[model samples]
Target: MDSLCPLTDAVIGDFAREDAAQLYTLVGRGARSHLKVLRNGLEISEMAVSDLPGNPNAVWTVKKNIEDQYDSYIIVSFVNATLALTIGDTVEEASDSGFLPTTPTLGCSMIGDDSLVQIYSEGIRHIRADKRINEWKAPPRRQIVRCAVNRRQVAVALSGGELVYFELDLNGTLNEFTERKLFNADIACMTFSEISEGELNSRFLALGTVDNAVRIISLDPNDMLMPLSTQNLPCPPESILLIDTPNDDGKGVAAVHLNIGLQNGCLFRNTVDNVTGAIMDTRTRYLGTRPVKLFKVQVQGRSAILCTSSRSWLLYHFQRRFHLTPLSYANLEYAASFCSNQCAEGVVAISASTLRIIAAEKLGVAFNVQSFEHRLTPRRIAVHPTKPCLVAIETDHAAYTEVTKTIKRNQMANDVEAMATDETEAELAREIAMNLREKKLDERVFGAPRAARGKWASAISLISATTGEKLTYFELPQDENAKCLALVQFSKHPDAVMVLVGCGVNEPLNPNTVTPEEAANRPVRGCVYTFHLSPTGDRFDFLHRTETPLPVGAIHDFRGMALVGFGRFLRMYDIGQKKLLAKCENKKKRYRERERKRKASES
Candidate 1:
């Protein structure tokens, strides 16, 4: 497969230094609960913990006492208790007194080595390793729909389109900052930009609503939770992403690129003014027929966008040009989410029933092959000089019958001659003759002999090279097989490009009735058909046809002249005048002189 971008599956445990290599997830429910450790996407170990109650509402990995090493323990929180399972070790119970007995854990995040934040139906709780707990409750009648966390801030969206922001202090305490409600909308999804170096908070918050619009909110202390701008959309967005690019004007403010994936499978892109938050240079592209989901992934050490729809597509830059192509290796059917923080060079795709970790690498070259109907066999192709299209010669089953009949007739005649030879070969020839007789009887019992249907049918197809789609086709006359194809512009229609096809008459000869010399000297007839493509490149218009005395075997363009090759000779003709311009015969003297002149020029 020649691919514009190629991706390969990552080896198991490829991210030894990252948390992706040591993934932990809960399987089954209640007494059947099992903790499975995964490397890449493959399971490496499993431990059953029947003591844990019910299904775990939240699972997260917390670092152990290894500062320079990759070691972590799994934290499984249930409705009533929390269990800490050490890797390849024993399981111990943690303090669950801080959590409400009935509130389910909606999400979880780690702020530091000792602080863990868990989102509940009613509020958020900060649980430290030393059993100290701090909590914050939402306003009355508000339900949390989504939450996004960073090292220094946490943003939560509620059912009534209200957004709450919390600032995490140096000691891992959550302080209520500000809250705002989006008018006439319901929140669907929200995310905060990553905190950069020397920065104490995320710069921006992107929110998607059920009313088919997106709003950018400034996270700066001066304008916390303030709406910067809002852009209306045709469909509800399913995902949102914001990427920061370096400032090129030396203005100290970086430019942010906004990407939104919509419910109708279209991806929207624009530039967001970091200072003003105004959208500019908006563009939209259709990716697939299903709803689109976007994820920021790392490929070959650079950040790229992975869009999931009917099939997975990757958007990245190569040699200063951006390329968006389908990933050949990953088919994310009903994928729930993708985790890149665990694997920097690849991604771990999570679905309802499976987890797939795939690594991406660059391909030297990429090409696409599209298949046509199985009844037609493509033999030769010629590309159009000026259009993004090509012409192909295709044959059907009737053409196959014509060729098969010729071979069978020739073979039977040879067998008959062999039987009449010396007696030393009589036994072998007799067996061969018996097999042929059986085959003949079988053919008679069957529908019909191939000779009875030995009629060739060939067609010229106009295809788009850019998309590998067959636009239209022109079928030839019955019993004529296409031998060659060419795209040329004639003097009569110099501005128009046309297709020229060389066709030979299908005439099955019986070897038993025709002698070798008679077959060799038989008159061969063929025709050269010219066709013009319509303005839309969808259909072909008949121009004219020229009858030839010999079977036309090849066709080419000779400096705007039609160069036609018969069995043993080449002729150049002026198509407008229908006059022969030049002729070259296949003779020994001409061939020797041509070869000698070519060798002299090389020396």
Candidate 2:
């Protein structure tokens, strides 16, 4: 309970991790001149952002979502914690920063959100910016915490079990707004569901309280006093996930995960119809025996439920008998937060940076798929909300690859691939065969569907992505310390994927540490090996090349965009071309100059 996931959005890694890396950008095969980052989120592999032949509008990742006339997301890099925006998409030179206070922050709350947002403390903020925003401070609260902005409504839980809500107003300054109270109880979380147009009072908000109770709060903001239904569940609900069914009976299901011991987690579902709040069916099933602190639950169908935690991810599909299926996964250290991105039909999970989007519907098999001997463990993973591909990975130390022989097998599918031919590729195949000879992969990475297609990760070392029936295993390269792995693999040649190994320099070069001036004269150098990897698994064509200007801490490749969280700043790399289109550039420059002059005059 003390260790919160610190993952507000599952797609992006922690700001510290991402901000530490430098990113390298490249041009995609098609779709040139696009403004996107080369890397997305935190991943070992680069993103394939280019569109296919027929799909010109297709993009690998979605940067932001339009929140309406007031604001729209323009730029977001966890390292910066600053979101750039346009007043409206059409408003030229009218941009805003979601910085609220315009400072480096570790925590954010809903201040503008009249609902659950009040004020949060015990977070990080920098001096340079905080001084400017809080100069009007009377009480002089030195350190502050940040809150979330866009959850629409807010729910505040007081000491004695009381919940309240208020109307959100972003149109005017904060002081000139009205507050509407909602409930009474210790609210764990509140989710607004089922809104009817023209009928304000008909909107229903479900509240889960500390007493393990469920209350349906109905309100028409126009008339604040309120009349809503308060329903109680038999069991104290640990976590509540709301899902709607298209049966037209106004029926929906709530997946309730009750807190059990580490090895005995139970998930139960009770059906309720909205038009007439009535209980239809309630079924409880013991899913597994693992205590999950930070688990995100997303409902696909009445029977299909996806639960993701730091340890593992489970897709529970109850057909005839209750079967708690285990999707194949290996070692995973840290997981932030993952969502189905509201796309629950075909495939759904949070994507890079947690900005959800639907992936293309087709799947293909990898030409070569093999396990490694290093036992690659995964760190973070995201699922394509509409597509079948899953992106699982481990936290990167530098850039290297680990060949894992530890095979965790579950269900098996008819698979065929052209085995590696060259000596190096052949050696890799032999290694995988010997490691997987005794045990099958299906048994280890269980909880998978017979006709399963998803992503799997293990030990922060390996990431396995399955596109329909196609599967590709990304293993870390061996390092001198055997602790680091390859972070980025780029193929300068069409046939090779560049390999970057991870390494850290040793301190205390002498018996004792050197002074600043002495150290400056002879500074220790960081190490990384960059070489070519041919499809034939050939020799390292060019090995042991170090990158200059050093590299950023976090690196990701999404299609043509390279996002490097560099020194608390998010660097966006547009790999579409060497430069911007000449025509557009001139017009943009002129517009910017004119706007700058006008702004200066007005000021």
Candidate 3:
């Protein structure tokens, strides 16, 4: 019962160091809250506009996302502070209107002593959360391509591997600044870490790429110019992460996960050392099995519990201390979610269509079986350092209460009820008209923003729900799994960064605004899933990227569990968390009835 994860509002960062129970998650736009979290099964707080100094324009900058993890309940994102979300323990927004970012919003999953948390975005000194907040200037030109912040400094990795590092003051002001040329490689992701006791002096960057290579570079405040690592791998790293382990250095270990095959498999054992980016030993191999799509699990000491694309559980261990380990196939068949030692009751996160805490106990000598489930399936799961036994829980709280189908169907009738008494005067009529219109501020746009309601091998599209305009389109890249592309806006703005993701055609598009038909026929437009979006106030077209496919079977306005399946029967999915929350079978009678209704409607 796996759900299409793209639609789930997952908080991907880490928990607080003192306590792993502090969870940070990403929610929908236009809501009164963005982050919904609870501690000890009690509602703690929801991140709202009260946390920032300003609200972003409803016309633009709506979908806020936590791109990556940094530090204590830390995250890096391009959020519209105007979001009606939480403002931590002691923070306030500039005004009542939701907008303005005050500080880091989410956390990294790894915990322990001396762990580093960082995030990157262009910010401006402005009134935020009532207390003059540094409004991160949402750039219409370069929408935060890459950013890395650590104990010593903050770095930004642009599209062309251009890196910028900044040292901040106590008041979060940039003090020292420097730039470097890290890679000619299309920089897919970048991270900064201080693997040594002297992080301020000894720091390095781990960069992942679609070109089947991971590059590690040295960071020196004096001669901080280029990378230090010289190793190259056959598999391109999709995510190069620096995490805390029960190992030495407290500096932790690095995991570079990538999609290693053409159409069949994934290489899960790509772990590296934090200090030296070279391949570590004792790598684990989970051969043949099946192909996995998306996987999220934590590494606890020598024990590695994994949930693959097959949605099965496999716990691996090795005698030697190295990156690789021998695979331990789970005699257990049903896989609920991922396994982690961080939970309160030795529970691992289990996901079907919904996410839940499934407790695990030693079934036999080398086998472990899970027990009961938790109260709620965490959209994002994490355990606290202070309370490793007590897990942090955030209810699958929706931005807004789910609107009933019957209520929505009767909106037109419920709304224009007083039409007969409306005035003819322009001002009076305008006022009346405004009162009758549905508030646009609360609309949930972009279930599938850039694409239309159709199926294909792959596609690209550009759509602006605000303007009801879907401009761009294309197909999947020949190289599946992972993709790296920049919109080749020919004879146009050189600064424009296009997330060019079309099928096969790597060629550029010529400058011409012909009819939609003409543009469609242009060889450049083949399966283009390009969405031309720019940060408000600027006039440069920016590219959009989606880690997973958008909602396929449901409409944009839908807020119910979509039973997404591969065969004739689909599994029930929890749309909010984005992970398959539970397994639900479609009632034969109900499904047949639905089909019958559709057939009658056509008649």
State which candidate has the highest lDDT: 1
Cα-based RMSD of candidate 1: 17.2
What is the per-residue lDDT of model 1 for residues 1-603, given as tens digits with 9 covering 90 to 100? 322121111112312232222322223221122222232221111112133345453454444322413324445556655555443343344344243445555556566555667777677888676868788887789888777775567788877877788887776678877456555787777777766556777788889899999998888778777889999999899878776644434356555778898999899988988668788889898877788877766544445677877656777655544567666433454221222234334454433233344555553223222223312345566656555555667654344343454467568856775767678577667667666645444221343343233356577777654344668767776677677888777776687777888887644333266556655765347788888776556667777788877678898877777888876667776564343344444423467788999999999
* Candidate 1 vs 2: which has more lDDT: 1
lDDT comparison, 2 vs 3, better candidate: 3
Q: Give the candidate order by descending lDDT.
A: 1, 3, 2
| Inter-residue clash pairs, candidate 1 | 2-366, 2-367, 3-366, 3-367, 10-359
Model 2, 90-183: lDDT tens digits are 3122142323333333322323322112232322211121222321121244332212122343333333443334343454122311443434
Ranking by TM-score: 1, 3, 2
Candidate 1 matches the true fold with a TM-score of 0.48
Question: Whose TM-score is higher: candidate 2's or candidate 3's?
Answer: 3
Q: What would the per-residue lDDT of candidate 3 be over residues 1-603, giving only the tens digit for each residue?
A: 222222223332223222122233323322221333322211111111112132221111111123222111212123432222222343222233223345432212221122222233444222222343343443355544555554345556655556555665555454435345646676655655434443433356666655656666666565564555544545554334443234443445434332222113344444455544554442334433454322223333333443343323334333334332111222112121222223322222223222123333322223211122212222222221221111111222111112322243345434444444534555564555555453333233322112111211222233221221223323233322111222232223333222323222312222243456653553322222233334231122323332222122211111233333322334443322222233355534467888999999999
